[model samples]
Target: MVQLDLIELADLVRPEQLVAEILRQNPQMPVPVPLEDLARLAGISKIEAFTSEGFEGALIANATKSQGAIFYSNRGPRPRQRFTIGHELGHFLLPWHRQAKFQCTAEDITSGGNKDWEIQANQFAAELLIPAPLVKTRLQKLKDPELAHIMALRDEFETSMEMTARRVVELSEYACAVIFSKDNVVRYPVWSPYFTHRLCVKKGERLPAKSPSREAASDPDEWHELDAHWWLVERRGEDTPESVYEQTLVQENGHKVTLLTYDPE
Candidate 1:
């Protein structure tokens, strides 16, 4: 194993660059990237379970010591725990991450705040778990971006469907978006760069009346064609309407994920 000082490893600003460098160093690194092993290799002395409430995980260190322990909530699901470990590792490795000790909440790990460090850490975790190159190859081979495909990716990658879906949108060539909602209220949406349409609904807004997400309560995992305007804010004076493919999946946790793909035809 190559000895990488914090400063040497932390120069990269982008998560992709960091992940690429990590993989470059450990060319034999396997899929599902053994985060705990990487943590240990990167100066983490131990990964222990914590019974703390509110916080998902934290990094323990001081100015004097480069190595530290990682603590994660024992109650979180295994997948979430893995993500938390990766998130804390990012905080440890990134030179720009100034906090010697970090206590991250669920939202900090998931929704990622406006703070640069939090966003970078979240990106690092996501890329480390589901490397963009692998995800891009998988997306290219898929005939259709269905809920089942996302679920399969989740299982194969040992990650949450939400994370897998977000990765799909981030790397896919198709114009697509994944909207997550709880109790019919939009929580957040991730969109592919090629997706030109702007989502009309904002966070905390109810699912549009005409949206297939509205039918998720009755018929989950169903796909339907919707008028683009139903989801996307229309361009002023534009008369032509495009068709958007919509699929809704109701998670066991009661969160609804609606996958939207624009017609490429």
Candidate 2:
């Protein structure tokens, strides 16, 4: 495989653009994108397994060259490992990511950070793994977003459930958001442009009393309509409608994903 330099890759400033260029160049690339193969083709010398304690993945460049090797944890699930590899590859291909080495933790790969490079790399990995165009098409076919639909999309894309949920929110026609929490505390929330209402909860905040996420502890995968005040803050004197729906799914590890949808009418 011929080594591809930054100039040869897309010159776009955003991660999504870079991914679009890659897909344009290789129209036949299969779903669940061939990350390892793409890495090798993009000048990654080796994809080695690491048993690191604190970090999920690392990209180390040679002292005299720009090309390097990618090392990912062998202990994480396959989906996670694939995402890590794609994230590291983003760091490798991004022109401004000039660091000779990068050691990234699980949070670095999974969440948006204050650093510009980390955010760009995450966007890149997401688009590479679950191309937005394809996701948009699939979402258009759904009459309503459901936990089962999200799970099926995750399995079809061979990506993490959180990733799939986020994509669903991004592409949904209705005002929607996906909240990830652990032990009742909010971790992060991803919402769509149409979702104008502000979420009352913030990172580390406990779930609202009437939240389906709280009920999910007992009945793991169920959808229910909760009072709007339970999750949204209404403006003074504004009439709050009762069309808010929430579905929560609890994983075996106690993490919860709550999908919120609102109907203004």
Candidate 3:
């Protein structure tokens, strides 16, 4: 493990609190959040590629969580690496994550199972890389919400489209939703807090046959009009609303992201 510059670490326990302290220290933090630099600042001594076949990232530190080395696999998409780095850093910093070493798999980083430690690490990574305040401020300055806006955020924040999309949903005031699908099968879906429509989404559910994400495959990242029922669960006695706008961003392979907005006349 190569040595890096050692910086003073903080005593905050919660993931959010520690990130707040980091932001407080680096008031002029830039977009895309110089993540590795921040990791080094938080006491990580070295970060190198890990050749482990299935693990996304790992942390090597003593029982007291000092003198840390982070490892990330080079095989995944480049966008995911930063998050993996942030995850290991989380494991290194959280006082209660008492493990001397952490070898986090893709599932552990992306979607943790029953382990609270992995879940907290994921939270730390998300909040550290994409601060909530920044997202809210950026969204307020933008015009009408569009999937293109999310695409722009993906680039600006240096995060995967799905990650950026989920962050936006967590803070957006508009009644909207994001759906991630592959080959017309829903994999993950998230809707804004303002969304009141009962969605039809279920893991492994077939995408609405006529949804724009599939029908307008030729034009990627374009918004189209559709009925709210396209993604909403219909009420037993009421008709589904009309004029729900959908903007779909087609991704590599069979992946697709559809943004839905509920606006009524």
lDDT of each model, Cα atoms only?
A: 0.81, 0.82, 0.82
User: What TM value does model 2 have?
Assistant: 0.88
Q: What is the alpha-carbon lDDT of model 2 when measured against the actual structure? A: 0.82
> What is the C-alpha lDDT profile of model 2 across 121-163, one tens digit per residue?
8889999999888888788887577888888889888899988
Candidate 1 lDDT, tens digit per residue, 75-142?
Answer: 97888988899899888877778778999998899868777888888889998988887777788899
Q: Name the runs in model 3 displaced over 4 angstroms.
A: 1-11, 216-218, 236-240
- Residue-by-residue lDDT tens digits, candidate 3, 1-265: 2122224344578889878777777776788888888777656789998688878899999777767899999988767998999999989888899888998988998897789999999999999889988888899997567777888898998999999999988789888888888987899889888887788878898888777677536454566787777778879876567768788877778888888887743
Best by TM-score: 3
Error of 2 at 134 (Å): 1.2
TM-score of 1: 0.88
Better of 1 and 3 by TM-score: 3
Deviation (Å) of 206 in candidate 2: 2.0
What TM-score does each of the candidates earn?
0.88, 0.88, 0.91
In angstroms, how far off is 217's CA in candidate 3?
A: 2.2
Question: Who is ahead in TM-score, 2 or 3?
Answer: 3
RMSD for each of the candidates: 2.7, 2.8, 3.4
